[model samples]
Structure formats: structure tokens, C-alpha cells
Target: MRFATYRHDGSTRAGVVDGDVVHALPAGTTVLDLVRAGLPAAVEAGTAALAEPEVPLADVTLLPPLQAPTVRDFVAFEEHVEGVRKAIDGVAGVPPEWYQAPTFYFTNPYALVGAHDDVAVPPNSQRFDFELEVAVVVGRDGASLSPEQAREHVFGYTVLNDWSARDLQAREMRVSLGPAKGKDSATTLGPWLVTADELEPYRDDEGFLALDMRVSVNGTEVGQDLLSNMGWPFEELISYASRGTEVRAGDVLGSGTSGNGGCLAELWGTRGEAAPPPLQPGDVVEMTVEGIGTIRNRVVAGVDLPPVAPARARPRTRKRPAAS
Candidate 1:
């Protein structure tokens, strides 16, 4: 069953989405609550008593599937990584360490927005871009989980658009550490959550879901790829994330940008820098994963704050020996 947290009758509540109609689950239920209970069981309990009325989806305002407890985004697609490397560094290859394990980064969970919401371009970002991907929501708590065990912990899937500020990211990545302000501005997830059981048919022989991922800006298509192209699957990502740490219910794991041209940075690097300019105010970004639905966000305006200066000392420059 598909589920969502949406605004209805002046209050936010959790509901099941069916045929463009939302059936209220319970008066105070939130998608996070259902995830905490484990999705299948929550569905059984929430629908046991069907007294609440159903509402048309068009009448309600949708929210992110849940207020995630924590968000971890991973780079599971090799083609995307190689393409991005080629674009940024002008050489194409995935790092050797990437093959050894799935690597991920913790991002701000509080920055999430839902489908149809307006995303604010962070201050000082001249190269804002969108990433087309899928996200998995955790259903159970576990530490040091094996890939097989990790598979059981996933409650559902949803489309994720990991908005980015490429100019900021490039500067920060050069310091060895990764994206900070560049990624903290916004992450879009929603339309609704499709429970794992609902996608049984799409699972490929290798266990990766064969979902078609697509992204478009304004009215033009920008990126498209199949989830099966990912070198590592969600189970591997979750298992790796659980190593030496705890993954709890409501935690979100994202499949980092799919497609060879997922974001503007990669596109600009591959094509001429003059083409596919960075996102501007009022640009509409729509990302969709087959079975999960689309998340359409409009770039509304930018934050007025200026970029913060580094407080630490700069690297010392070496002097040539007596100007040889």
C-alpha cells in the first residue's frame, strides 16, 4: 500500500493513497508513526477500523513522507559517478575504494520538502542543480546488519531529489571533506511512499529494482536512467550504513543521482560550460521514479545571506630556493 503525510481539514495527518484518493489512517497518525510500527503491521492496524472518510488527493497539501529521523545519501551508481568525475576532473573512473564498499554521507534531515513545494536556492549559489534518485525508509533498528538482514529493514521507497549547489560543493570537496552548505539547503521526497511488498514484481535477478528514473527542468528533459544500472543495491547500502552504527526506523537512505547527466555540474562539464546553465529562480524541477511517482518543485527565490568566510588560516605557500 502507498502512504503519505498530508494536510487535510486544517491539520496534517497520515493516510493511504489509492486511485487518487487518500483514506485517512487515524486522526493523529503520521507517516513516521507507521514506519516506527513497521509498515505492513501498521497498514493492517490502521485499516482495521475504516471509519475515517476519504478525500481526493487534489484537495490536500502533501508533506514529505515522514520527518526522517536521519538521512543518509549514498552513491550507488557507477555510471553516474564516472560521468560526474569526467565532467569535473576531465577523466572518467570510479575510485578504487568505491568498489570496496558503499560510501555515503549524512545530510540534514530537517531540510526535506515535499512534492509541489518551492525550494529556495541557497545564498551565493550560482550553480544550483537537481539530482534524480530514489530513497529507502528504514523500518527496523539494527547495527552491523548483513545485506540479507538489511533488506528486511526497508519499509518503503520514494523518489528523492537531492538539490545541490555545485559551486559550493566543488570548493568544499577540494578540502577533502564533502558537501556542506552546498547540500543542506533542500532535499525533496514525496508524492507518496510505496511499500516494499508492492514492488515485488519489479525486483530484478540481482535484487535491484528495475525502476526508470527521470528528471526534467521547466518543460525539457534533463536526465533519465534505470535503477538497475546501480552498481550497488539498496541492501548493500543499508548494510554498509549499519556498520559500527545504528540505523533506526524513520531513517532515510537515498540512491544518489542516477543517469549520466543527472545534475547541471555533470552536464555542464560534459557539454560546453555555456549550455544548461545552473538553476535560476522560478525553474521547475520534476523527478520521477517509476512506481514511486513524481516530485515537482519550483525554484522560488534565493536566501539573501552571504557566504561565510573560513575562520582558519590559509595554507602556506612555499618559496622557491633563492629564485634559482
Candidate 2:
């Protein structure tokens, strides 16, 4: 069953797609809430009429599939990693240790935009690019899980656009030791969340989700890749992420960029360097991951960004851990 977090008549709700109709839920109106509620048949018991596809699909704003207690985006695609290392620094291939370990970075939860939402180009950023990726949403909670035990933690899957501002990102990382502003702004997710049962067949088929990915901006095809190219599979990332810290059911894990040089930093070189037509103010970016759906948004001026707030620090838990 295809499920979506959508809005109807100004009220946001969880919905299921039945043919061309969008069946909107009443009270427990969200993807996270639906998972928490065990997808009871009782809740899907209403709908006097099926909503028109075009009206609801574009009208109902999308939300990140999971409320996500935490979001750790991992860079496991070798081509992407290699391109990133070599692009500015001229270094090819990741360190052996990088392959041995799963690297990830935390991102702001509030900077999320649903499918069809307008994407703002940050001011002074000439390198505005998109990464087409598949993300895994955690279901059951646990820590120190074995690889064999990792599958149970996954709730579902969705697409992720790790939108990047290359200039600010590159500057901060040199001092901060990793990606900061290069990735801090808005992350786009969804068309809808596809359940684990529906996605299981794709795992380990060559690698990761075996779907073809194609992206276009303002009618121009720029990026395309296969989901099977991931360096680390979802199960491995899940097990590794839960090694010590608890990973909750609603938390989301992103499989960074889908291909080699998929984003501008890797594709067209950075600003002042004259890249191939950087995303102008009025271009429309559209991405589609097979079996999921497509998300299209117009690029607006960075001045349109909603107000920025002070960053929140993740504080240590009040209680310390016990000896294992």
C-alpha cells in the first residue's frame, strides 16, 4: 500500500493512495503517527469520495516520512565520495579507513520541504545542487544490534535530496572538520513512504534498492543513477548506527548521494570557476526514484528562505550508562 502524509482543506493528514484517489485520514494524521498506531484498519475506515489525483497530489503538502528523532546522512557511495575528495583537493578514492567505516553527519530537522514545495537558493551560493538518494526510516528501537538483527529496525523507505551550498559547506568543513553549512539548509523528502515489505525484494540485488533514478531541472536532464550503487546497504548502516547509541523507530538514515559527481560540487566545478550553468533563480528541479514517485519544485530566490533560528545543541542524557 502506498502511504503519504498530506493536507486537505488546510488540515494536514495521513493518506493512502487507492488507484487515482487519495484517501485522507482524520485524527491520527501523519506518517509517524500511522506507524505508531500499527496501521489499524479502523483508521482507514472513512472517505465519502476519492480526491482527484492532481488536486491532492500537488495540493497536499508532503512532510518527512518520519518525525525522525535524529537524522544521520551517510556518504557510502564510492563514486560520490571519490569525486568529493578529488573535486576540490584533486584526491581520488576514499581512504581505506573510510571504506571500513560508515561516515555520517547530522542535519537540521526543521529545514525539511515536502514534494512540490518551492526550494530556495541560498544567497551568495552559486553552487546549488541536488543529490538523488534513497533513505531508510527506522522502526523498532535498539542499540548494539548485530547485522542479522538490523532488518527489524527499518520502518520504510523514501527519496532524499541532500541539497548543498558548496561555497559555505567547503569553507566550514575546512575549519569544522566536516560538512556543516554545505549541508545545513533544506532537505527534500517524500512523495510518500513505501513500507519495508514492499521494498524487501530490492535489497542485495547487486546492492541496495535496485531502481533507476533520473533527475531533470527546468526540462533539462542533469542527473541520473541506479539505487543499487550504494556502497553500504541499509541493513549494514542500520546495524552500525545502532552500535552504541539507541536508534529509535521514527529516526531517519540517509544514503547520501546516489552517483559519482551527482551534485554540482562534483559535476560542474564551484563558483568563480565557471561551472556549466549553475541553478539560476527560476529553474525547476524534478527528481524521480522508480517505484516511489516524482518530486518537482521551482527554484526561488534565497531571500525567500524562512527565518533562521539559533541552533540547538544535543545535550548528554541525564543518566549515564551501566556496565555491559
Q: How accurate is candidate 2 locally (lDDT)?
A: 0.72
Task: Report the backbone clash tally of model 2.
Answer: 2
lDDT tens per residue, model 2, 1-324: 566777668877777766545776555556676555443332343232244233446455666555666788998787777666655454566779888878888887778788778888876677777777778887777898877788766667888888888766766666747676677678888877777777667666454678778788778777778777887788889988988887877778898886743665556432324354667778887888877778777788887444446569978699878989
The lDDT for every candidate, in the order shown, is 0.85, 0.72
lDDT: which candidate is best? 1
lDDT of 2 at 315: 82
Worst 10 residues of 1 by lDDT: 45-54
lDDT of 1 by residue, 1-324 (tens): 888889977999888887788888867778888899886687795565244677999999999989998999998888778767665555667799888878889899989998989999888888888888899999999999999999999999998889998878877887889878879999998989889988878999989999988888898988888998887889888898999988999999998888666776667666656368889999999887888898899997786885586689857769745864
Which prediction has the highest TM-score against the true structure? 1
- Give the CA lDDT, 0 to 100, for residue 18 in model 2: 62
Please, what is the TM-score per model? Answer: 0.92, 0.83
